[model samples]
Target: MAHDLTTPRDGIPPVLSTPASFREAAAALASGQGPLAIDTERASGFRYDDRAFLVQIRRRDVGTFLLDPEGHRTEFTAALAPVLNGQDWILHAAPSDLPSLAWLGLYPGSLFDTELGGRLAGLDHVNLAAMTELLLDVRLAKGHGAEDWSQRPLPANWLAYAALDVELLLELGDTMAEILDNQGKLDWASEEFEYIRNTHSTITGPAEATWRSVRGVASLTRPEQLAVARELWMIRESIAVEEDRAVSRILPNKVLIEIARLLPRTARELVRVKGFRRSEVRFWGEIIQRALESDPRTWPTRDRPPRGLPSRQTWAAEHPDSWERFSNARTLLDDLSADLAIPVENILKPAVLRTVAWGATVGREIRSPLDLPDVLRDYQARNWQVELTAPILTETLFR
Candidate 1:
């Protein structure tokens, strides 16, 4: 049985056999539609981060093309820049995909997330397959559940899986839009979707660290934790970059924090940390030791984050309304998320909510939709984020 691709793929289905084909495809992408449907597949089970072992972009009215980031060296600057320059993109779960794309030098713009739309519109089940089935009556098969996308000459099964991955996205987004419009929730979802498209990559460089971002580290002495954190952070950064994977692939934050607090001074000390398996220590033990031994006092304090967590009592005292608002927001988020068949956390992350709460109270602003990231002034001036803080703050705090 001959399989058909999602679309004609610019009349030449990007083979990605060489640089020339890639360049041609990139040019085609720029000249194509204003919005595109995109998905990526990587060897995540075997590797650390989700990278474009295979990048699939389907431009409405144009076609879907698969880019081989590994084999093709065609600069994505020209091809991807135009699409992202001032265009809207439709994606189901774009938040997860876009970050990794940024690492590979592609950042999308003006997103319309159907999953988000479904939630705002009070619909049920927003996963691509479910949404497509409900909206378009297309029962996309899910056979390629664990296919390895890194392998060249992608298998027929995988290609079908990939094609079906985006075949109904454009239609599904349109259906979700109609539903949103009917419910008077279009503006709300549109605001949130715009926020999603404009999201920037959180991972900046090796020098800037995230291991210390873990909770409970504040219990440790600031200097000691900072020194160990910097060391572990740098180690993780190097490992991630070298392995071309996410830092968590090297080790999760819990393990990293545990190691930092323990300040494992030697290979033998490494064993005390729960997740620090012997092989991991064998690979990174020396480096860890050097970091633990470094004088925390001498380490630069300019960017050393304060190591601590706020007591529940202190948090409650600081923002009496927050707990209620957070609780209300969580229930709303959970209900809507379950209705849309997406994870609740996907719609409103608690970390983002924390930042929103603090920013509003400290900055003295009111924002809408009480449970998103803070509408920072500087962030607002620069990026495309919606100034949603004002209304959210008012409803959640003042009201």
Candidate 2:
């Protein structure tokens, strides 16, 4: 039975927020040996800026360091970025964390993503907690994952949770590497890690016209509903940005959708809608009415934005030949996945496969008969992936 992993073996380290402290932290880290195990805490749903407020790093000789990136921005960039870059890093779900770190000018020299390693090793569950239990026999307690990391003077328990993130990460990375080596997949994992490191963008801020991402917004097909949802989203965005609070705290997507659907005419009516609080109705009642009464021209002109790659389910009826080609290629991929013990998505990204299948069926022009490799590269398939799948795709798709 796996026991709960609660406290850090070294106890919770104090947060380093000052330039002087950051310099010391960098010095300490530089002296430590081996790859660094790192994690970052972000207020994704709680703040408009998805920046890493807190960064956790650990090494063998040096103890863990919890850094406040927001406190000493210039100092942090100058001090830690030098020590951090040009070193092998072990991260979990690096795609999520890399962008945030990169926003602060921190980049990894090379990476070993434990989560991706577990996936390559064909583990049933690859999350940090799951891998810990399976590989290290320790159960990590769950809490504070959704906390507002922007809050200053983080509580001790939250600090402990943060510390625990990196406490075992180095050990986990080592074990995961061993597993990959034994399975003859360390090279494959390396290629995937490099692809992720190179491809992830440093832009970490929320996107413009963000309302389209709200839950259930796509389900509302009516023009009026889309308009109301957009209005609510705009108001929520403004409030969240100005106040530095999560948009959901201002108005949850479900409540926004509810008000959009009902188009309530009065504060009394808006308050009655389930999930919408009366206090919110009193404050935004006028804004809601204006949205409903606004000129139809001002409303979102499109009911739903245009999307690429028609749904795969519709292909059988609308594009039978493409569907047949996709199905045949997908079957070959599945067999390859089983033989290689790699997930199909890991073998080739699903979107790339779909695009390739469709393009091949339509006789999309190519420079040469051996143009499959070039096409795969265009779709962001790495060299290792191309080596494994291009021949099979050429035989099944191009021919």
Candidate 3:
């Protein structure tokens, strides 16, 4: 009963790039009667931060409108503000799309993330195409997601692919809602959707964590290498923000790590290193060499602060008691996950589990089972999550 969704039933319209086009599209969409099915194409890994280049919105009868938001921010916002206001939105994976949309001043009133709903409904594959196929019996054509959407005069095939992104979302949302309601997870999914709607980030560029997040930064053995990598990462990040380009596209992780590893002393030496073939490498080498030549006295400590409890690798040998508790907790949580038909991550954040185990045993942060609520709250565990998990963890950590 599955058919390939190669094109929109009404066909793809022209990209609404101009103010007049946006207004017309808005008027058409506003007249349609239903929640909006929305999706955005962002150049995250390929460009800078998640800035949306294309926004696709669909309604019951309005069909699909591909919005070109670049260089027309004001027009795009002004025209569509009234249309999107106070309307529920259906998005496949809400988190990735929401940030860029928020950057464009588009916020949802209510959200139904089909991907999350699929997880709550206990579906195996929670991606957009997978959920649509399972719940709507329609297979979507994909493979355009990784392309640079900022290109003008977008290809016909890519447009069709983008159109299909929102085309089935309305029916898919309805079908998913019915399943969630039948499975008695409607309230849970509602809570999740509301959480996503309320929480959005409009950050345009890298934050403090950018350098540390580089692929091979953690693997560099020497403190000097980390210092050099951090410096090089900052240079890449600054240029990425200024030009609105992706950091990796500007300076690949493989090349950056190699330069840092070699501790290249000059622009000439820097360019000679392996994996340094970019056209900009010679120019970037000068700026990078400055960081490498700086005094080592100012270098940061080699060890970055742990994100959470001591690394689990060390827990067994360095902190055996906490390791044992963590082991037991995982087993208990895994069994609970199976019983409730919810993924382990959906039941409780993995960080919360690790922190709770360490807190109760080694950290001595929990005095008794009564202390579980406050500890869990610190991690922003949802009320429903805390309710479902508190008793289970209280017994596990305390015992």
Q: Which model scores highest in TM-score?
A: 3
For model 1, how does the per-residue alpha-carbon lDDT over 213-314 read when each residue is reduced to its tens digit?
A: 656555556566667767777777787778766666677777877876777777788887887778877766776767657765676342446643355477
List all candidate RMSDs to the true structure.
Answer: 6.4, 2.8, 2.8
With a 3 Å backbone cut-off (N, CA, C), the pairs that clash in candidate 3 are 47-245, 47-246
Report the lDDT tens digits of candidate 3 across residue range 1-399: 988888877887788888889999999998998899999987677677777899999998778899998889988988998789668899998988887777777788899999899998889999889888887889999999998888788999999999999988999999999999998889988988887777663443334556777777777878788888888888887888799888777778898888878887765777687767657766777766667678988775566656666676888999886787778778888998898789999989998888788878888877788988877878877778888889888766787
TM-score of each: 0.68, 0.88, 0.90
Q: After superposition, how far is residue 14 of candidate 1 from its true place, in Å?
A: 6.2
Q: Which candidate do you rate higher for lDDT, 1 or 3?
A: 3
lDDT values, one for every candidate: 0.63, 0.85, 0.83
Compose the digit string of candidate 2's lDDT tens values, residues 1-399: 899978887788999899999999999999999999999999978787678999999998998999997967878989998999878999999998988888787888899999999999999899898999999999886588889898888998999999998888998999999999999999999999998887764453434658887888878777877888888888888888799887777888788888888888877788889888876666678777777788987777544466566776776888887787678888999998998788999989988888777767764654343878898988888888999888777777655
Error of 2 at 48 (Å): 3.0
TM-score of 3: 0.90
lDDT of 2 at 126: 92
User: Between prediction 1 and prediction 2, which has the larger lDDT?
Assistant: 2
In candidate 2, list every pair of residues with a backbone clash. none
Off by over 4 Å in 3: 201-215, 218-227, 266-274, 278-281, 295-308, 317-321
